[model samples]
Target: MAAEMTVSELVRRARDGQARALGRLISLVEDGSPRLAEVAAELAPHTGGAQVVGLTGPPGVGKSTSTSALVKALRASGRRVGVLAVDPSSPFSGGALLGDRVRMQEHATDDGVFIRSMATRGHLGGLAWSTPQALRVLDAAGFDIVLIETVGVGQSEVDVVSLADTTLVLLAPGMGDGIQAAKAGILEVADVFVVNKADREGADQTVRELKYMISLGRREKGPSWRTPIVRTVAARSEGVDELVQAVTDHRDWLIEHGELDARRVQRAENEIQAVVAARLRAEMGELRGGATLAGLAREIVDGRSDPYRAAEQLLADLRS
Candidate 1:
Protein backbone atom coordinates (compact mmCIF):
# COMPACT_ATOMS: atom_id res chain seq x y z
CA MET A 1 0.00 0.00 0.00
CA ALA A 2 1.14 3.53 -0.61
CA ALA A 3 2.01 5.54 2.44
CA GLU A 4 -0.57 7.93 3.75
CA MET A 5 0.53 11.56 3.67
CA THR A 6 -0.39 14.49 5.83
CA VAL A 7 -2.01 17.67 4.55
CA SER A 8 0.91 19.70 5.85
CA GLU A 9 3.39 17.69 3.80
CA LEU A 10 1.32 18.11 0.66
CA VAL A 11 0.88 21.84 1.17
CA ARG A 12 4.55 22.41 1.97
CA ARG A 13 5.82 20.36 -0.95
CA ALA A 14 3.39 21.98 -3.36
CA ARG A 15 4.32 25.46 -2.22
CA ASP A 16 7.99 24.56 -2.62
CA GLY A 17 7.29 23.92 -6.32
CA GLN A 18 7.10 20.13 -6.40
CA ALA A 19 4.84 19.56 -9.40
CA ARG A 20 3.99 16.00 -8.41
CA ALA A 21 2.84 17.04 -4.99
CA LEU A 22 0.82 19.88 -6.48
CA GLY A 23 -0.82 17.47 -8.92
CA ARG A 24 -1.62 15.11 -6.08
CA LEU A 25 -3.27 17.89 -4.09
CA ILE A 26 -5.43 18.75 -7.09
CA SER A 27 -6.39 15.08 -7.47
CA LEU A 28 -7.45 15.01 -3.84
CA VAL A 29 -9.69 17.93 -4.54
CA GLU A 30 -11.10 16.26 -7.67
CA ASP A 31 -11.78 13.02 -5.82
CA GLY A 32 -13.55 14.86 -3.02
CA SER A 33 -11.29 13.29 -0.43
CA PRO A 34 -12.38 13.04 3.19
CA ARG A 35 -9.35 15.18 4.08
CA LEU A 36 -10.30 17.84 1.55
CA ALA A 37 -11.55 20.21 4.24
CA GLU A 38 -8.23 19.97 6.01
CA VAL A 39 -6.27 20.51 2.79
CA ALA A 40 -8.35 23.52 1.88
CA ALA A 41 -7.97 25.04 5.32
CA GLU A 42 -4.22 24.52 5.14
CA LEU A 43 -3.93 26.14 1.74
CA ALA A 44 -6.36 29.01 2.40
CA PRO A 45 -3.69 31.39 3.61
CA HIS A 46 -1.49 30.84 0.57
CA THR A 47 -4.14 31.55 -2.09
CA GLY A 48 -5.52 34.86 -3.46
CA GLY A 49 -2.16 35.85 -4.90
CA ALA A 50 -2.56 34.51 -8.43
CA GLN A 51 -4.56 36.25 -11.11
CA VAL A 52 -7.35 34.03 -12.49
CA VAL A 53 -7.98 34.60 -16.18
CA GLY A 54 -10.45 32.52 -18.21
CA LEU A 55 -10.31 31.92 -21.97
CA THR A 56 -13.56 30.76 -23.57
CA GLY A 57 -15.32 30.76 -26.92
CA PRO A 58 -16.97 28.52 -29.46
CA PRO A 59 -15.24 25.36 -30.62
CA GLY A 60 -12.33 25.82 -33.07
CA VAL A 61 -11.55 29.35 -31.86
CA GLY A 62 -7.90 28.52 -31.06
CA LYS A 63 -8.24 28.76 -27.26
CA SER A 64 -5.56 26.16 -26.59
CA THR A 65 -3.06 27.72 -28.99
CA SER A 66 -3.76 31.17 -27.58
CA THR A 67 -3.27 29.84 -24.07
CA SER A 68 0.10 28.33 -25.01
CA ALA A 69 1.10 31.61 -26.61
CA LEU A 70 0.06 33.49 -23.49
CA VAL A 71 2.12 31.14 -21.38
CA LYS A 72 5.17 31.85 -23.52
CA ALA A 73 4.57 35.60 -23.30
CA LEU A 74 3.91 35.63 -19.54
CA ARG A 75 6.92 33.45 -18.77
CA ALA A 76 9.11 35.77 -20.81
CA SER A 77 8.19 38.44 -18.25
CA GLY A 78 9.35 36.12 -15.41
CA ARG A 79 5.91 35.10 -14.22
CA ARG A 80 5.04 31.55 -13.22
CA VAL A 81 1.92 30.37 -15.07
CA GLY A 82 -0.55 27.55 -14.49
CA VAL A 83 -3.08 26.29 -17.05
CA LEU A 84 -6.37 24.50 -16.34
CA ALA A 85 -7.67 23.14 -19.64
CA VAL A 86 -11.15 21.77 -19.10
CA ASP A 87 -12.13 19.23 -21.76
CA PRO A 88 -15.26 17.26 -22.53
CA SER A 89 -15.45 13.94 -20.71
CA SER A 90 -15.66 10.48 -22.19
CA PRO A 91 -19.08 8.94 -21.76
CA PHE A 92 -17.72 5.51 -20.84
CA SER A 93 -15.20 6.37 -18.12
CA GLY A 94 -15.64 10.08 -17.58
CA GLY A 95 -11.95 10.72 -18.16
CA ALA A 96 -10.49 13.70 -20.00
CA LEU A 97 -8.76 13.22 -23.35
CA LEU A 98 -6.01 15.63 -22.20
CA GLY A 99 -5.68 17.00 -25.71
CA ASP A 100 -4.70 20.43 -24.44
CA ARG A 101 -1.83 18.99 -22.45
CA VAL A 102 -0.57 17.28 -25.59
CA ARG A 103 -0.79 20.54 -27.52
CA MET A 104 1.15 22.33 -24.80
CA GLN A 105 4.03 19.82 -24.76
CA GLU A 106 6.51 22.57 -25.62
CA HIS A 107 6.32 23.65 -21.99
CA ALA A 108 6.68 20.14 -20.58
CA THR A 109 10.27 20.78 -19.52
CA ASP A 110 9.62 24.30 -18.24
CA ASP A 111 9.68 24.31 -14.47
CA GLY A 112 7.83 27.60 -14.30
CA VAL A 113 4.73 26.23 -16.03
CA PHE A 114 2.14 23.66 -14.91
CA ILE A 115 -0.60 22.40 -17.21
CA ARG A 116 -3.56 20.23 -16.18
CA SER A 117 -6.52 18.96 -18.16
CA MET A 118 -9.81 18.22 -16.41
CA ALA A 119 -12.90 16.32 -17.60
CA THR A 120 -16.21 18.08 -17.64
CA ARG A 121 -18.03 14.77 -17.03
CA GLY A 122 -21.10 15.98 -18.81
CA HIS A 123 -21.27 19.17 -16.80
CA LEU A 124 -22.71 21.93 -18.95
CA GLY A 125 -21.36 25.49 -19.09
CA GLY A 126 -17.90 24.23 -20.16
CA LEU A 127 -16.45 23.69 -16.67
CA ALA A 128 -16.03 20.67 -14.46
CA TRP A 129 -17.68 20.48 -11.05
CA SER A 130 -14.30 20.31 -9.29
CA THR A 131 -12.76 23.17 -11.25
CA PRO A 132 -13.10 25.85 -8.56
CA GLN A 133 -11.34 23.72 -5.98
CA ALA A 134 -8.65 22.76 -8.48
CA LEU A 135 -8.11 26.47 -9.15
CA ARG A 136 -7.64 27.00 -5.43
CA VAL A 137 -4.90 24.41 -5.40
CA LEU A 138 -3.09 26.19 -8.24
CA ASP A 139 -3.51 29.57 -6.54
CA ALA A 140 -2.05 28.25 -3.28
CA ALA A 141 0.85 26.65 -5.14
CA GLY A 142 2.26 30.12 -5.98
CA PHE A 143 1.40 30.50 -9.63
CA ASP A 144 1.56 34.14 -10.69
CA ILE A 145 -1.16 33.69 -13.29
CA VAL A 146 -3.73 30.90 -13.71
CA LEU A 147 -5.38 30.50 -17.10
CA ILE A 148 -8.62 28.50 -17.19
CA GLU A 149 -9.47 27.26 -20.69
CA THR A 150 -13.02 26.00 -20.78
CA VAL A 151 -14.60 23.51 -23.17
CA GLY A 152 -16.11 25.23 -26.17
CA VAL A 153 -19.83 25.29 -25.30
CA GLY A 154 -20.94 28.49 -26.97
CA GLN A 155 -23.53 30.58 -25.11
CA SER A 156 -23.92 28.58 -21.90
CA GLU A 157 -20.24 28.99 -21.14
CA VAL A 158 -20.79 32.27 -19.31
CA ASP A 159 -20.10 30.59 -15.98
CA VAL A 160 -16.42 31.35 -16.58
CA VAL A 161 -17.17 35.02 -16.08
CA SER A 162 -18.13 34.30 -12.49
CA LEU A 163 -14.92 32.36 -11.90
CA ALA A 164 -12.40 34.50 -13.77
CA ASP A 165 -11.25 38.00 -12.87
CA THR A 166 -10.90 38.63 -16.60
CA THR A 167 -12.54 36.61 -19.40
CA LEU A 168 -11.17 36.56 -22.95
CA VAL A 169 -13.65 35.69 -25.68
CA LEU A 170 -11.99 34.53 -28.90
CA LEU A 171 -13.43 34.41 -32.41
CA ALA A 172 -11.97 33.73 -35.82
CA PRO A 173 -12.62 34.89 -39.37
CA GLY A 174 -14.45 32.83 -42.08
CA MET A 175 -16.74 31.33 -39.43
CA GLY A 176 -19.60 33.84 -39.38
CA ASP A 177 -18.56 33.93 -35.74
CA GLY A 178 -19.34 37.59 -35.21
CA ILE A 179 -23.06 37.18 -35.85
CA GLN A 180 -23.10 33.91 -33.99
CA ALA A 181 -21.36 35.55 -31.06
CA ALA A 182 -23.96 38.28 -30.76
CA LYS A 183 -26.76 35.72 -30.99
CA ALA A 184 -25.09 33.54 -28.40
CA GLY A 185 -24.65 36.45 -25.98
CA ILE A 186 -20.87 35.95 -26.01
CA LEU A 187 -20.18 39.65 -26.38
CA GLU A 188 -21.39 40.43 -22.85
CA VAL A 189 -18.86 38.23 -21.14
CA ALA A 190 -15.66 39.48 -22.73
CA ASP A 191 -13.16 41.71 -20.96
CA VAL A 192 -10.97 41.35 -24.02
CA PHE A 193 -12.27 40.34 -27.45
CA VAL A 194 -9.61 38.46 -29.37
CA VAL A 195 -9.89 37.78 -33.07
CA ASN A 196 -7.54 34.88 -33.44
CA LYS A 197 -6.31 33.44 -36.76
CA ALA A 198 -6.12 36.97 -38.04
CA ASP A 199 -4.38 36.03 -41.27
CA ARG A 200 -7.64 34.72 -42.73
CA GLU A 201 -9.41 36.63 -45.49
CA GLY A 202 -12.36 38.00 -43.49
CA ALA A 203 -10.24 39.21 -40.59
CA ASP A 204 -10.82 42.89 -41.17
CA GLN A 205 -14.52 42.39 -41.75
CA THR A 206 -14.85 40.37 -38.55
CA VAL A 207 -13.12 43.15 -36.64
CA ARG A 208 -15.45 45.75 -38.14
CA GLU A 209 -18.54 43.65 -37.34
CA LEU A 210 -17.38 43.11 -33.77
CA LYS A 211 -16.68 46.80 -33.33
CA TYR A 212 -20.13 47.63 -34.65
CA MET A 213 -21.74 45.09 -32.31
CA ILE A 214 -19.83 46.47 -29.33
CA SER A 215 -20.90 49.97 -30.15
CA LEU A 216 -24.59 49.01 -30.04
CA GLY A 217 -24.40 48.86 -26.22
CA ARG A 218 -26.29 45.56 -26.25
CA ARG A 219 -24.18 44.45 -23.30
CA GLU A 220 -22.84 46.98 -20.83
CA LYS A 221 -19.96 45.06 -19.28
CA GLY A 222 -18.02 48.09 -18.12
CA PRO A 223 -19.07 51.54 -17.09
CA SER A 224 -15.57 52.99 -17.19
CA TRP A 225 -13.76 50.58 -19.47
CA ARG A 226 -14.12 49.65 -23.11
CA THR A 227 -13.35 46.05 -23.95
CA PRO A 228 -10.51 46.28 -26.47
CA ILE A 229 -10.42 44.09 -29.56
CA VAL A 230 -7.13 42.22 -30.12
CA ARG A 231 -5.97 40.47 -33.27
CA THR A 232 -3.73 37.44 -33.07
CA VAL A 233 -2.46 34.57 -35.16
CA ALA A 234 -1.76 32.32 -32.17
CA ALA A 235 -0.18 29.54 -34.21
CA ARG A 236 2.53 31.91 -35.45
CA SER A 237 2.69 33.86 -32.16
CA GLU A 238 1.72 36.97 -34.08
CA GLY A 239 0.01 39.73 -32.06
CA VAL A 240 0.54 37.70 -28.88
CA ASP A 241 2.37 40.57 -27.23
CA GLU A 242 -0.56 42.87 -27.97
CA LEU A 243 -3.01 40.29 -26.64
CA VAL A 244 -1.03 39.90 -23.45
CA GLN A 245 -0.84 43.66 -23.08
CA ALA A 246 -4.60 43.87 -23.48
CA VAL A 247 -5.04 41.33 -20.69
CA THR A 248 -2.65 43.29 -18.50
CA ASP A 249 -4.54 46.48 -19.22
CA HIS A 250 -7.83 44.88 -18.24
CA ARG A 251 -6.32 43.60 -14.99
CA ASP A 252 -5.05 47.09 -14.24
CA TRP A 253 -8.43 48.54 -15.04
CA LEU A 254 -10.14 46.12 -12.69
CA ILE A 255 -7.81 47.15 -9.86
CA GLU A 256 -8.37 50.83 -10.62
CA HIS A 257 -12.17 50.57 -10.73
CA GLY A 258 -12.60 48.62 -7.47
CA GLU A 259 -14.02 45.71 -9.46
CA LEU A 260 -11.24 43.35 -8.43
CA ASP A 261 -12.40 42.93 -4.85
CA ALA A 262 -16.02 42.91 -5.89
CA ARG A 263 -15.34 40.17 -8.44
CA ARG A 264 -13.41 38.06 -5.92
CA VAL A 265 -16.22 38.45 -3.44
CA GLN A 266 -18.65 37.28 -6.10
CA ARG A 267 -16.49 34.28 -6.88
CA ALA A 268 -16.44 33.26 -3.23
CA GLU A 269 -20.17 33.71 -3.05
CA ASN A 270 -20.70 31.43 -6.04
CA GLU A 271 -18.39 28.79 -4.64
CA ILE A 272 -20.17 28.83 -1.31
CA GLN A 273 -23.56 28.54 -2.95
CA ALA A 274 -22.42 25.64 -5.13
CA VAL A 275 -20.96 23.79 -2.15
CA VAL A 276 -24.15 24.20 -0.19
CA ALA A 277 -26.21 22.92 -3.10
CA ALA A 278 -24.02 19.87 -3.57
CA ARG A 279 -24.12 19.04 0.14
CA LEU A 280 -27.86 19.37 0.19
CA ARG A 281 -28.13 17.04 -2.79
CA ALA A 282 -26.06 14.44 -1.02
CA GLU A 283 -28.10 14.83 2.13
CA MET A 284 -31.37 14.45 0.28
CA GLY A 285 -30.08 11.30 -1.35
CA GLU A 286 -29.74 9.63 2.04
CA LEU A 287 -33.46 9.21 2.49
CA ARG A 288 -34.41 5.82 4.03
CA GLY A 289 -35.37 4.19 0.74
CA GLY A 290 -33.51 4.94 -2.48
CA ALA A 291 -36.70 4.20 -4.35
CA THR A 292 -38.50 6.98 -2.50
CA LEU A 293 -37.20 9.48 -5.06
CA ALA A 294 -38.41 7.39 -7.98
CA GLY A 295 -41.63 6.71 -6.12
CA LEU A 296 -42.16 10.43 -5.70
CA ALA A 297 -41.64 10.97 -9.41
CA ARG A 298 -44.06 8.14 -10.15
CA GLU A 299 -46.64 9.69 -7.88
CA ILE A 300 -46.30 13.01 -9.71
CA VAL A 301 -46.66 11.31 -13.05
CA ASP A 302 -49.72 9.36 -11.96
CA GLY A 303 -51.42 12.60 -10.84
CA ARG A 304 -51.66 11.35 -7.28
CA SER A 305 -49.35 14.17 -6.09
CA ASP A 306 -48.14 17.31 -7.77
CA PRO A 307 -44.42 18.14 -8.08
CA TYR A 308 -44.73 20.89 -5.43
CA ARG A 309 -46.17 18.48 -2.89
CA ALA A 310 -43.75 15.74 -3.86
CA ALA A 311 -40.82 18.09 -3.29
CA GLU A 312 -42.26 19.04 0.09
CA GLN A 313 -42.52 15.34 0.99
CA LEU A 314 -38.88 14.84 0.08
CA LEU A 315 -37.85 17.71 2.36
CA ALA A 316 -40.05 16.32 5.11
CA ASP A 317 -38.37 12.95 4.79
CA LEU A 318 -34.97 14.65 5.01
CA ARG A 319 -35.96 16.51 8.18
CA SER A 320 -37.10 13.29 9.80
Candidate 2:
Protein backbone atom coordinates (compact mmCIF):
# COMPACT_ATOMS: atom_id res chain seq x y z
CA MET A 1 0.00 0.00 0.00
CA ALA A 2 2.82 2.36 0.86
CA ALA A 3 4.68 1.61 -2.36
CA GLU A 4 1.50 2.36 -4.27
CA MET A 5 0.96 5.64 -2.40
CA THR A 6 1.98 8.62 -4.47
CA VAL A 7 4.46 11.11 -3.06
CA SER A 8 1.80 13.80 -3.04
CA GLU A 9 -0.58 11.54 -1.18
CA LEU A 10 2.06 10.61 1.33
CA VAL A 11 3.06 14.21 1.95
CA ARG A 12 -0.57 15.26 2.23
CA ARG A 13 -1.40 12.45 4.64
CA ALA A 14 1.74 13.13 6.62
CA ARG A 15 0.78 16.78 6.95
CA ASP A 16 -2.67 15.64 8.04
CA GLY A 17 -1.08 13.72 10.92
CA GLN A 18 -0.86 10.26 9.45
CA ALA A 19 1.96 8.32 11.08
CA ARG A 20 1.93 5.57 8.49
CA ALA A 21 2.56 8.01 5.71
CA LEU A 22 5.37 9.65 7.65
CA GLY A 23 6.95 6.27 8.31
CA ARG A 24 6.80 5.33 4.64
CA LEU A 25 8.41 8.59 3.62
CA ILE A 26 11.28 8.03 6.02
CA SER A 27 11.61 4.46 4.82
CA LEU A 28 12.18 5.76 1.33
CA VAL A 29 14.97 7.93 2.68
CA GLU A 30 16.65 5.11 4.59
CA ASP A 31 16.51 2.67 1.69
CA GLY A 32 17.67 5.25 -0.83
CA SER A 33 14.57 4.56 -2.86
CA PRO A 34 14.15 5.71 -6.43
CA ARG A 35 11.43 8.12 -5.29
CA LEU A 36 13.65 9.84 -2.74
CA ALA A 37 14.05 12.97 -4.83
CA GLU A 38 10.28 13.21 -5.27
CA VAL A 39 9.74 12.66 -1.56
CA ALA A 40 12.23 15.40 -0.72
CA ALA A 41 10.63 17.76 -3.21
CA GLU A 42 7.19 17.15 -1.78
CA LEU A 43 8.43 17.73 1.76
CA ALA A 44 10.62 20.75 1.06
CA PRO A 45 8.04 23.47 1.66
CA HIS A 46 7.22 22.12 5.11
CA THR A 47 10.85 21.79 6.16
CA GLY A 48 12.54 23.91 8.85
CA GLY A 49 9.49 24.01 11.11
CA ALA A 50 10.76 21.74 13.85
CA GLN A 51 13.66 22.52 16.15
CA VAL A 52 16.28 19.77 15.83
CA VAL A 53 18.06 18.97 19.08
CA GLY A 54 20.91 16.47 19.18
CA LEU A 55 22.04 14.44 22.22
CA THR A 56 25.39 12.67 22.08
CA GLY A 57 27.97 11.29 24.48
CA PRO A 58 29.94 8.26 25.56
CA PRO A 59 28.19 4.95 26.13
CA GLY A 60 26.56 4.20 29.54
CA VAL A 61 25.73 7.84 30.19
CA GLY A 62 21.97 7.16 30.05
CA LYS A 63 21.38 9.04 26.79
CA SER A 64 18.37 6.92 25.90
CA THR A 65 16.84 7.39 29.34
CA SER A 66 17.46 11.11 29.19
CA THR A 67 15.89 11.28 25.74
CA SER A 68 12.77 9.59 27.05
CA ALA A 69 12.71 12.05 29.94
CA LEU A 70 13.03 14.90 27.47
CA VAL A 71 10.17 13.52 25.36
CA LYS A 72 7.96 13.43 28.45
CA ALA A 73 8.92 16.97 29.35
CA LEU A 74 8.26 18.26 25.86
CA ARG A 75 4.95 16.44 25.61
CA ALA A 76 3.89 17.77 28.99
CA SER A 77 4.40 21.28 27.66
CA GLY A 78 1.94 20.46 24.80
CA ARG A 79 4.59 20.02 22.15
CA ARG A 80 4.55 17.24 19.62
CA VAL A 81 7.89 15.43 19.75
CA GLY A 82 9.68 13.07 17.37
CA VAL A 83 12.72 11.07 18.37
CA LEU A 84 15.36 9.58 16.07
CA ALA A 85 17.36 7.11 18.12
CA VAL A 86 20.46 6.06 16.17
CA ASP A 87 21.35 2.60 17.39
CA PRO A 88 24.11 0.18 16.53
CA SER A 89 23.36 -2.17 13.66
CA SER A 90 22.82 -5.88 14.03
CA PRO A 91 25.63 -7.62 12.24
CA PHE A 92 23.39 -10.17 10.55
CA SER A 93 20.37 -8.18 9.41
CA GLY A 94 21.89 -4.69 9.58
CA GLY A 95 18.92 -3.45 11.56
CA ALA A 96 18.79 -1.39 14.69
CA LEU A 97 20.11 -3.57 17.53
CA LEU A 98 18.25 -1.68 20.26
CA GLY A 99 14.61 -0.80 19.77
CA ASP A 100 13.70 2.41 21.53
CA ARG A 101 10.01 1.42 21.70
CA VAL A 102 10.99 -1.18 24.29
CA ARG A 103 12.85 1.34 26.38
CA MET A 104 10.25 4.11 25.97
CA GLN A 105 7.13 2.03 26.17
CA GLU A 106 5.22 4.79 27.96
CA HIS A 107 5.22 7.01 24.89
CA ALA A 108 4.28 4.22 22.53
CA THR A 109 0.58 5.00 22.57
CA ASP A 110 0.89 8.78 22.53
CA ASP A 111 -0.56 10.38 19.40
CA GLY A 112 1.78 13.33 19.57
CA VAL A 113 4.98 11.36 19.93
CA PHE A 114 6.76 9.39 17.21
CA ILE A 115 9.88 7.35 17.95
CA ARG A 116 12.14 5.57 15.47
CA SER A 117 15.38 3.69 15.80
CA MET A 118 17.82 3.91 12.88
CA ALA A 119 20.74 1.54 12.57
CA THR A 120 24.15 3.15 12.23
CA ARG A 121 25.18 0.50 9.64
CA GLY A 122 28.81 1.25 10.49
CA HIS A 123 28.55 4.84 9.30
CA LEU A 124 30.93 7.12 11.17
CA GLY A 125 29.99 10.10 13.35
CA GLY A 126 27.61 7.87 15.32
CA LEU A 127 24.65 8.41 12.99
CA ALA A 128 23.05 6.67 10.06
CA TRP A 129 23.86 7.84 6.54
CA SER A 130 20.30 9.01 5.99
CA THR A 131 19.66 10.88 9.24
CA PRO A 132 19.33 14.33 7.67
CA GLN A 133 16.71 13.12 5.25
CA ALA A 134 14.81 11.34 8.04
CA LEU A 135 14.85 14.55 10.04
CA ARG A 136 13.33 16.31 7.03
CA VAL A 137 10.50 13.80 6.93
CA LEU A 138 9.73 14.36 10.62
CA ASP A 139 10.01 18.10 10.27
CA ALA A 140 7.57 18.11 7.38
CA ALA A 141 5.23 15.95 9.44
CA GLY A 142 4.91 18.99 11.70
CA PHE A 143 6.54 17.88 14.92
CA ASP A 144 7.36 20.85 17.13
CA ILE A 145 10.63 19.41 18.36
CA VAL A 146 12.72 16.61 16.87
CA LEU A 147 15.29 14.95 19.12
CA ILE A 148 18.23 13.05 17.66
CA GLU A 149 19.86 10.55 20.02
CA THR A 150 23.16 9.47 18.53
CA VAL A 151 24.86 6.10 18.81
CA GLY A 152 27.07 6.52 21.86
CA VAL A 153 30.46 5.39 20.61
CA GLY A 154 32.43 7.76 22.80
CA GLN A 155 34.48 10.30 20.77
CA SER A 156 33.10 10.11 17.19
CA GLU A 157 29.55 11.39 17.63
CA VAL A 158 30.27 14.99 16.77
CA ASP A 159 28.53 14.87 13.36
CA VAL A 160 25.28 15.71 15.15
CA VAL A 161 26.67 19.20 15.63
CA SER A 162 26.18 19.96 11.94
CA LEU A 163 22.49 18.96 11.94
CA ALA A 164 21.07 20.13 15.26
CA ASP A 165 19.85 23.59 16.16
CA THR A 166 21.14 22.99 19.65
CA THR A 167 23.58 20.20 20.51
CA LEU A 168 23.69 18.70 24.02
CA VAL A 169 26.72 16.75 25.17
CA LEU A 170 25.68 14.34 27.92
CA LEU A 171 28.16 13.10 30.50
CA ALA A 172 27.97 11.12 33.70
CA PRO A 173 29.90 10.83 36.96
CA GLY A 174 32.92 8.46 37.07
CA MET A 175 33.03 8.28 33.24
CA GLY A 176 36.09 10.50 32.83
CA ASP A 177 33.97 12.22 30.17
CA GLY A 178 35.55 15.58 30.82
CA ILE A 179 38.96 14.47 29.62
CA GLN A 180 37.50 12.24 26.94
CA ALA A 181 35.33 15.05 25.62
CA ALA A 182 38.33 17.33 25.33
CA LYS A 183 40.37 14.66 23.62
CA ALA A 184 37.53 13.96 21.17
CA GLY A 185 37.30 17.65 20.23
CA ILE A 186 33.59 17.58 21.06
CA LEU A 187 33.89 20.18 23.77
CA GLU A 188 33.98 22.92 21.13
CA VAL A 189 30.84 21.63 19.40
CA ALA A 190 28.60 21.46 22.46
CA ASP A 191 26.05 24.21 22.91
CA VAL A 192 24.83 22.90 26.27
CA PHE A 193 26.39 20.33 28.58
CA VAL A 194 24.21 17.86 30.42
CA VAL A 195 25.59 15.96 33.37
CA ASN A 196 23.23 13.02 33.69
CA LYS A 197 23.07 10.72 36.72
CA ALA A 198 23.77 13.75 38.85
CA ASP A 199 22.81 11.97 42.06
CA ARG A 200 25.65 9.49 41.68
CA GLU A 201 28.82 9.79 43.74
CA GLY A 202 31.49 12.15 42.36
CA ALA A 203 28.84 14.00 40.35
CA ASP A 204 30.03 17.35 41.71
CA GLN A 205 33.58 16.55 40.78
CA THR A 206 32.47 15.74 37.26
CA VAL A 207 30.58 19.03 37.11
CA ARG A 208 33.65 20.93 38.32
CA GLU A 209 35.81 19.29 35.70
CA LEU A 210 33.35 20.16 32.93
CA LYS A 211 33.13 23.72 34.17
CA TYR A 212 36.88 24.10 34.19
CA MET A 213 37.10 22.65 30.72
CA ILE A 214 34.36 24.93 29.42
CA SER A 215 36.11 27.96 30.87
CA LEU A 216 39.40 27.03 29.29
CA GLY A 217 37.91 26.25 25.86
CA ARG A 218 35.52 29.15 25.50
CA ARG A 219 35.11 30.40 21.94
CA GLU A 220 36.86 33.62 21.06
CA LYS A 221 34.09 35.09 18.88
CA GLY A 222 30.77 34.02 17.42
CA PRO A 223 27.32 34.16 19.04
CA SER A 224 28.69 35.40 22.35
CA TRP A 225 26.60 32.74 24.07
CA ARG A 226 27.72 30.78 27.11
CA THR A 227 27.16 27.05 27.30
CA PRO A 228 25.10 26.17 30.39
CA ILE A 229 25.60 23.01 32.41
CA VAL A 230 22.48 21.16 33.56
CA ARG A 231 22.51 18.16 35.86
CA THR A 232 19.93 15.42 35.67
CA VAL A 233 19.03 12.08 37.15
CA ALA A 234 17.18 11.00 34.05
CA ALA A 235 15.82 7.80 35.53
CA ARG A 236 13.89 9.84 38.11
CA SER A 237 13.13 12.65 35.66
CA GLU A 238 15.10 14.95 37.91
CA GLY A 239 16.42 18.28 36.59
CA VAL A 240 14.75 17.68 33.23
CA ASP A 241 12.74 20.84 33.39
CA GLU A 242 15.90 22.86 33.90
CA LEU A 243 17.44 21.12 30.92
CA VAL A 244 14.41 21.97 28.83
CA GLN A 245 14.63 25.55 29.98
CA ALA A 246 18.28 25.61 29.02
CA VAL A 247 17.38 24.35 25.56
CA THR A 248 14.76 27.06 25.27
CA ASP A 249 17.31 29.65 26.31
CA HIS A 250 19.73 28.48 23.65
CA ARG A 251 17.08 28.62 20.92
CA ASP A 252 16.19 32.15 21.92
CA TRP A 253 19.85 33.10 21.89
CA LEU A 254 20.26 31.66 18.41
CA ILE A 255 17.38 33.71 17.10
CA GLU A 256 18.52 36.83 18.95
CA HIS A 257 22.06 36.54 17.66
CA GLY A 258 20.88 35.68 14.13
CA GLU A 259 22.74 32.38 14.29
CA LEU A 260 19.80 30.14 13.55
CA ASP A 261 19.54 31.16 9.89
CA ALA A 262 23.30 30.97 9.55
CA ARG A 263 23.38 27.48 10.95
CA ARG A 264 20.59 26.32 8.67
CA VAL A 265 22.41 27.75 5.69
CA GLN A 266 25.51 25.83 6.61
CA ARG A 267 23.42 22.69 7.07
CA ALA A 268 22.03 23.09 3.57
CA GLU A 269 25.50 23.56 2.15
CA ASN A 270 26.70 20.40 3.82
CA GLU A 271 23.71 18.42 2.59
CA ILE A 272 24.32 19.49 -0.97
CA GLN A 273 27.99 18.56 -0.75
CA ALA A 274 27.09 15.15 0.64
CA VAL A 275 24.71 14.48 -2.24
CA VAL A 276 27.28 15.51 -4.82
CA ALA A 277 29.91 13.34 -3.22
CA ALA A 278 27.57 10.35 -3.12
CA ARG A 279 26.75 10.75 -6.80
CA LEU A 280 30.41 10.97 -7.69
CA ARG A 281 31.16 7.85 -5.69
CA ALA A 282 28.44 5.95 -7.52
CA GLU A 283 29.86 7.03 -10.86
CA MET A 284 33.33 6.03 -9.73
CA GLY A 285 32.01 2.57 -8.87
CA GLU A 286 30.60 2.26 -12.38
CA LEU A 287 33.94 3.31 -13.81
CA ARG A 288 35.72 0.68 -11.76
CA GLY A 289 33.39 -2.01 -13.09
CA GLY A 290 33.75 -0.88 -16.71
CA ALA A 291 36.70 -1.26 -19.12
CA THR A 292 38.02 2.30 -18.48
CA LEU A 293 39.59 1.55 -15.07
CA ALA A 294 40.78 -1.91 -16.18
CA GLY A 295 42.51 -0.45 -19.23
CA LEU A 296 44.16 2.23 -17.06
CA ALA A 297 45.38 -0.38 -14.61
CA ARG A 298 46.79 -2.52 -17.43
CA GLU A 299 48.64 0.52 -18.82
CA ILE A 300 50.10 1.32 -15.42
CA VAL A 301 51.10 -2.33 -14.93
CA ASP A 302 52.79 -2.42 -18.36
CA GLY A 303 54.64 0.89 -17.68
CA ARG A 304 52.86 2.54 -20.59
CA SER A 305 51.34 5.30 -18.36
CA ASP A 306 51.98 6.68 -14.88
CA PRO A 307 49.39 6.54 -12.05
CA TYR A 308 48.96 10.35 -11.99
CA ARG A 309 48.26 10.48 -15.74
CA ALA A 310 45.84 7.58 -15.50
CA ALA A 311 44.09 9.42 -12.67
CA GLU A 312 43.80 12.47 -14.92
CA GLN A 313 42.24 10.29 -17.66
CA LEU A 314 39.75 8.93 -15.09
CA LEU A 315 38.89 12.48 -14.08
CA ALA A 316 38.32 13.41 -17.71
CA ASP A 317 36.05 10.40 -18.16
CA LEU A 318 34.09 11.45 -15.07
CA ARG A 319 33.75 14.98 -16.44
CA SER A 320 32.41 13.66 -19.73
Q: Ten residues in a row with the worst lDDT in model 1?
A: 120-129
lDDT of 2 by residue, 1-320 (tens): 87898999999998887888888898888777888899989999999989999998777889889999999999999999998887543435645534754854787678799888777543222243478888999999999999988854544356655689998888889886465656756567788999999999989998898788767866532548888899999999999999999999999999999999999998888777777777676676588577788898899999999999998998999998
TM-score of each: 0.93, 0.90
Cα lDDT of model 1 by residue, 1-320, tens digit: 11287888988988998888888998887777787789889989999999999998777889888999999999999999998887643445544544745755798788899988877543222243478888999999999999998754553356655689999988899876555666766677888999999999999998998899778887676677898999999999999999889888989999998998889998899877777777767776666656778889899889999989988998888778
TM-score of 2: 0.90
- Model 2: how far is 121 from its true place, Å? 4.8
Question: Which pairs clash in the backbone of model 1?
Answer: none
The prediction achieving the highest TM-score against the true structure is 1
